[model samples]
Target: MRSNHSCTVSSAPYANITCIIHDDCILPCSFRPTGTVVIHWYKQQIPVHSYYYNKDQFGLQNKHFSGRTCLFNSHIPHGNASLLLRRVKVQDRGRYKCYTSTRKGNQEIFINLEVKALIQSVNMEMTDETVTCSSHNIYPIPQVTWATDPPTAQGALENQTTIKTTDHKGLFTVESTLKILDNLSNHTYFCSFISADKTQVWTASWKNQEDITQEEGHALSISCIAPRGLQNFSLTWTFTSSSEPTVISRYDSRTRHTFNLWEGQAEPNQDLLLLGDGSLLLHKPDSEEHSGTYTCTFSGLQSRHIVQTKVNITVASISVDERSVQRSWWSTAASAAFVLLTVIVALPQCVRQRAVETSTASHRCNGAGQRWTDGLSAV
Candidate 1:
């Protein structure tokens, strides 16, 4: 006789299961414990997985679920008949039926499965005053958005180019590029990739720090701080003064070495760059050649970019003494010009006043002389 013929079985009318692509998942089912157990999992009457005679039976299993479905054998006696699916695929999304039979009775449950291929990484890089954000192999077409830390005008986001392409596997690749105008350097920019269902979101950020001013023959250091706890990461620094960007150096933690691409562009200290914080140290930097924008990118596994930091370096060509001398010369010239203008304006008014005074004096002398002559005539 069975151990529990009167054991009760319970299950929900409907169950929902969500799984990520290239990952494992489980479809749940519940029943009463009994010595004799029989379970069969199906996708719309298509045989997925079956268990009977205290063992798994796959002779009639579907080809799509071959070697990918299994029931919890150890938990069978305890009334758990859940099916474990490995390396889920997009086609495995639909309603499934889990049928269980024990000595007590028989039970069945309906389950709905959803498969999603989430975005693995987002890459953001700046070239020629334009930043581009891109991602690949995403299912269910994602949405892209750009934002600034200080919240810039909407025109900044509107003036971008975004493209989405579908690969042969029906996966989407999205790329968006935004022009970094001079006015936007004060604000940090962020790009986000969001799934249509809003279940998965990946974002990356970039910021351009204030320009670093250095003398002509001074040693310059560009600091790039990445997030903590990165394994097998890569550090790439690029220099751009004009339209094109040149790769300065590249350091990979796995290789434990630095690869200098352009010699004269930037000479990164091998020891200091890959040491703790990954900051670039230039021994002696030239004023004209080294004055440009330096961008550092940190990439994790599979070359997926994590974050970016940009530094602007300005090499002052003029010395402090030269500036002071220029200021003094301008001051002296302005003072002399002011005095000349004052003399020119006052001399005209003085000449006009003198002429009026002379005319009045001559008229007074004539009147006095005429009055005396008239008195003599009267005498």
Candidate 2:
């Protein structure tokens, strides 16, 4: 190895790449090579992969990289020696070296790789009144299970999964869905994912989702949640009945902004407001104003990322009697009762006067009869 005195010292090629753990990642190394040469991929000092004399040499490769590392041989003819790594583990993080050598000289590139875990938000959908929990953009397939506080989630319910490429990078994206046969109304079902070693990665639970119907001039409540590890996201409540949904409230975790009624009526709900699991509480809702197809959208901080759940809030109007509107029931009943009492008191006085008059007439008749009989006897 020799350094040309005339050649100016250049900065070491530095590449910082982020990848989801348990997904495939590529350590980039690009250059225009004319002929076949020796390619060496090393993690720090350990030999990850090596290609020599137009063939792979695994004898010198590290045991950890036995089957996980490969080189794009097709690209090597055009001078690309990027190593394709599969199922990136936590220990794979650190600096890597991609060295290529020809008959006379050698070239090198340095790479800094990072592995991260993304806990996607879980969405529960009710179709024909059946609850289905689903999530997307998950990395390195984790074990998804459905559970409950009481009458725990049985193992009988099966889960469905799918895998796909996430980006230009070799990382993978997974989608999972769980269908619940047991009733979710009375019990709080927990849908979560765990690491290979049984560590709690994320969880979602619901128990208090009672009937949300309300009469006019009453309160209404609805709630939603994301995974446990997720912290930064946007929560928006939109009324979807209109041509274009109108945003009722929006809370952005990145900017810490609370727009609209997020903190309008009741301030205590703010605790549950900014959290991963958000709630909507309309302290006083009018039947005509607040009823419609409502949607809660949870968008990730990244671009073009969102999870949505729909809720049909029914606020029915109640009919009122026109007579009741004129006067209160209690007030009208009191007035009628007072009038009846006065009639009863006046009737007793009239009856007593009539009785006295009849008694006087009877006494006068008896006196007249007695006087007539005495005059006849004297004659």
Candidate 3:
């Protein structure tokens, strides 16, 4: 004999089910020590308006769940009371309960049903040819649909004709291929997912790339290319020093097409330019102040793209005094010439002094010889 208190459901407390329109979802609930018993299904606390027992007998179920609810099996002996809900609806959101009653008593299990309202899939691919959009994740997979703004009715539409879905790790993913129809224009596309209870949408965008380049210590022209047809879009150019790359200069521009650097100029005619290619040009490039990364961003339609490029200014050192080095060289040469002249003047005086000493010694020798001669005669 099995005790009513010990019999319990084995599945987790919440339901982990998702589905799209025209899809089927299974709510699995298993119990212990099961036998043949009368099984019933309910939404919230109310019984289902219609149901089937043992695959043959049918009965009244809830009005909301009519034609959509089914039992996997009613025989509790087999331990299967799983429910299958088909053609789910937004109103299907609520708690569902399954009950099994035997001659002894009744046992129950509960499931929380959630109906997703939006099913969105997003895919992004960057290539030289086009930007492709794809679906990332969808539960209870639905038929994918694609839409775009500035309608693709013109020959400008170049998207791949087919959209495909792939399943990985029990989740469904889809993708759409879109090619660049116009290089000068910006385009946006939407991918949507449809289900009985939920609907989701995602957007992908592309724009023409813009850039600028220039030298230091001069005025530079910076322009950003806006999508060819967009009239209300705004563009701005910002200038910053290289030492603290985040420090903005006063010469930054509020409009994309024109930039004036009267304030951030290190010298006259020196300014920074923002170009359509998202490149920065310094009028007079100063290696000390203009060497670092410059970032450009375009914001519109609740989306933005940020591109950063490094501006390296090669500075040539300018000599302040042109004659200083030449003067030092001439001074060293003059000192060497003075030392040579002193050596030349003292060498002749040293030679003359040696000759005078030799002459005095010779005179002394002659005097000694005469004295000896006189001594001999006296003797």
Candidate 4:
């Protein structure tokens, strides 16, 4: 006799089986049998899988589970009558029963198969300034929940979810967004996607990146690539100092150009805007004032989202290179003077020598006799 079948819980399920959609699910219902016993798995009194006489008895199996159902026959000797269900779907979420007929009597094992939708990959975007998190590629209905290290932030944020069914597969693609009314940092946003069976929560974290260092008077150009694709963004490129942040440039499509420090002066190519890149042609730090922190802030496009990237600018002087540039400039000026002197001093001497050679040739021809001068005098 099977001890597991001693006290049967036929009214409710013995256990709940949770699994993701399109993945394999195991409906566990096992009792140590004597030898070969009859096994029947049912859903709502309908036959899903049946096995008897030491083989899979699928003649009476339901057509809906054809080629998609299997019994763990290798474990038949050990009485592990777990049924493996393949390629789960939303319709597979239901209560099921397992009937095992033995020499002692008939045993009933019940199970609740709960299949949930899943997102294989989640793309999360976080903005710490406003505490907003956004992501797509989710499934079913999604909700956003706020969580902190100490669990202080709860019910303080709001959730916004949107879902659309895919064209060919008909699977749901959910977009979950959250906004924290009170802005703070060092927090994480959780996006919970719930289906009929289970709830999966994904987290979006807020953390700063590494700082940057550069030599003074060298060109600096960095890609201000934001993870979020804001339709229209109000970007502010700022250089931070000990006192306050000075605006290098601020622009948006609507505002055009709010303020640009390098607008009139040539150098650093003012054409390369802050939104594009903060570039200064032949730019150098005047003093320690230029060396501080810098950041590009993007806002307004996303209603509750504020994205910012900080760059700690350490402007170090290139002493050797600076002296070399000075020396190179003076050397170039001296070389230009030497070339001009060579041309000026050598030109008049060559002209005077050519005039003397012509006079000498004329005297030699006059002294050559009347015979030689006859043809020349007539000409």
The TM-score measured for candidate 3 stands at: 0.34
Q: Per-candidate RMSD vs. true structure? A: 17.4, 15.6, 14.7, 15.5
Better of 1 and 3 by lDDT: 1
- Those runs of model 4 whose alpha carbons end farther than 4 Å from true positions after fitting are 1-14, 20-24, 30-38, 52-54, 72-82, 100-109, 117-121, 125-142, 146-161, 164-172, 177-201, 206-213, 216-339, 342-346, 349-379
lDDT of 3 by residue, 1-379 (tens): 8555434333346665654434667776665434445667778777762223445234555566667777664344567767788876655667877776554556667777765534443435545566555554455455545445556664555455545554533445555565665552344444444543433333334333333344456555343333333333333344456344342322223443434453444311223233324334445656676665554444444233333344555555435564677678789999999999998999899889888888888899999999999999999
What lDDT is obtained when candidate 4 is compared to the true structure?
Answer: 0.60
lDDT-based ranking: 1, 2, 4, 3
Q: Residues 238-272, candidate 4, lDDT per residue (tens digit)?
A: 66677777777766745565667755421333454
| lDDT tens digits by residue: candidate 2, 1-379 | 7653222322256889977777898888865465667888888999999998898899988888889988888778888888999988767888998887764357778999877667555655544333455555554456666666566435644544433446544334444544545454455455666644454356555443444566655566666655455667777776654567787788888888887853454222567756676667777666556666555656553311223334344555435775566568668888888898988998899899899998999999999999999999999
Q: If both were scored by TM-score, which would come out higher, candidate 2 or candidate 3?
A: 2
lDDT of each: 0.79, 0.65, 0.52, 0.60
* Over 4 Å off, model 1: 1-11, 127-130, 168-170, 179-187, 195-200, 207-216, 221-281, 286-293, 298-379
Question: Against the hidden true structure, what lDDT does model 3 obtain?
Answer: 0.52
lDDT for residue 299 in candidate 4, whole number 0-100 = 49
Give residue 310's lDDT in candidate 2 (0 to 100). Answer: 40
Model 3 residue 171 distance off true place after TM-score fit, in angstroms: 1.2
lDDT of 1 by residue, 42-161 (tens): 999899999999999999999999989888899888889899999888789999999888777778899999878888899887654888899998887889899887888888777789
Instruction: Please give each candidate's TM-score.
Output: 0.59, 0.43, 0.34, 0.46
